[model samples]
Target: MGQGKTSLVQRLYQRAVARYWARSARSAATARLAVLRQQSQKAQDLRRHLNRVIAVSQSRLALPLIGSNSFPRPHGTDWAWRPELWRQPLDRVGIASVANRESLGAEVTLFHDCAVSEVTLRQIRNTREADLAPFGVSMDVLGFDGSFLSLVVDLPDEAVRGLKRSHVIRLDTIVEQESPLEIFVRLNVKHGPNTEQVVHELPVNQEVNTVEFDLAYTKLNEKRVEKAWVDLIFEGPEMNRVILRDATFSRRPRAEF
Candidate 1:
C-alpha cells in the first residue's frame, strides 16, 4: 500500500509540473504578441511621416533650382534681369476665369476688355532639360471677344536708375503655343511728364524670340526716367493655350556709329 501511495504521489507531481509549464508558455506567447503589435503600430506611424517628407522633398527637388538668375547676355551688357515669377514660387499658383486688371504675382498683371471672362492663368514648373527658368506662366483662352489682351510686367526700380538715351534694352522670351500666334512686346519708360514707348513684334513658334529697343531712337528723357514696364499684347488669341516659358531683359550701350 505504501508503494502504491508513493507511485500515485509521483504521478500527481508530474501532472502539476506539466500544468504549470503549459500556463507559463501561454503567458509568454501573449506577452510576445503584445510586443509585436506595439512595434507594428510604431512602424506604421513612422512610415506615414516618412511618406510625407519624401513627397515634399521630391516635388521641390524635381523643379529647377530656385532663385536662379542666370541667362545669356550680350557682351558689355550692363543690366540683366529674370522676373520674380520665373525665378521663384508665387503665393498663388493659379487663377481661373480671370478678371481684368487681375494680378498673378506682385509684379505681373493681366488686362483685357472682354465682356465675359474666359481666361485662366497658372504658374507651371519647368522640367524640360532645355528650359532655363524655374517657373513658367500658362494662359488658356476660349471664346475671347475682347478688343485687347495684354500682360504687363512692372520693372524694378533698378531698371530706370541712371537711364540714358544711348542704351539699348533687349527683351528675350521663349514661347510655346498650340498654334501660330502674333505677339508684341511694348516697352514703356516713364519720364518726368511724358511716357516714351516702343513696340516690337515677336517671332513666336521659335526657339528664342528676342526684340531690342534702342533708346537712342525713342524720345526718351534721359535725366527723368522714373519707371519702366513691358506690355505683352496678344492678338486674336482665341482658343489657344500659350505658355511663356521664359522672359528676360538685358541692357547694353549702342555702339557709336
Candidate 2:
C-alpha cells in the first residue's frame, strides 16, 4: 500500500477503537463502569502525552537540522568566524557598564538609557551543559526602561572595501532567552551623509538561527563607503537574560552569470 493509504487505514483503526471504547463503557454494569472510567481516564492522559510528543516532534521537524561543528555553504564561503567561540584570547569580551551611546570595546559599543544597576554584561567561558560554544557574552537585563538599546560592531577596514555589492553577509548564532522578546539585527554601511541599513528580525524560540544581508539590493554606495557597522538591537528586553552562544559571519560573492 502507499504511504497515504497506510495513514488512512491507521486513522480509521483509531476511530474504530475510540468508538468501541465508548460503546463498551456505556453498556457496562455499575461496578464495571467505575473500573472502565478509571481506565479511560488513564488512557486519556496517555493520549494527551502522546499528542504533546507529536506536537513537539512536528515543531522540531519543521526546522532543518544543521550540524554543530560546521556550517554548510553550498555556494562556498569567503570569510567565517564563530565570534562567541573565539580561539584567541580577547581583550575585553564583557561590558558591564551602563549603555548609552558609549563605547564598549575597541570595536563594540552600547547605546541605551538603562541604569547601571538594571543591566550587567559579562564574558563567560561556556561551561554550561547547554552551551555549544567555548566562550560567550552574557547580558542580564534586570529592567530595560530605555527607548532604545543596541550593541554595535564597527566593521573592520577590510570589510568596508572587501564587502561588495554582489556579496552576501550571513550572521549565524545561538541565542538564549529568559522570556519571549523580539530582537532585530541591522547591517549598516555609511557612504556619505546617508547611512544605509538593512534590518533582520530574529525569532527567539529557535535553537539554530541565521540571517543574511544581500548588498546587491541595498542603495549603499560601495565606492564611497566611509564606514561600516552592525547593530544588534533589543526590543522590550526588561527582566531578561540574553546569551550569545556563538555568532559568526560569512561573506560570499555572488556567482558569476
Query: Scored by CA lDDT, what does every candidate get?
Result: 0.88, 0.70
Once superposed on the true structure, which residue ranges of model 2 sit more than 4 Å away at CA?
A: 1-74, 82-97, 115-117, 128-132
lDDT of 1 at 239: 97
List model 2 lDDT by residue over 1-257, tens digit each.
65545577788999998897787666656547677788778778978988999987763443222233444553667766444223223566555646576553466577787555476776655555554455566778876667888877776666666667888888877888888889899998888888888999998787568899888889877678887778889998888888876666677887778
lDDT of 1 by residue, 72-174 (tens): 9999898999999988899998999999999998999999999998999999988886888989999999989989999999999887788799998998999
Each model's TM-score, in the order given? Answer: 0.80, 0.64
Q: Which candidate is the best by lDDT?
A: 1
Weakest lDDT window of 10 consecutive positions for candidate 1:
20-29
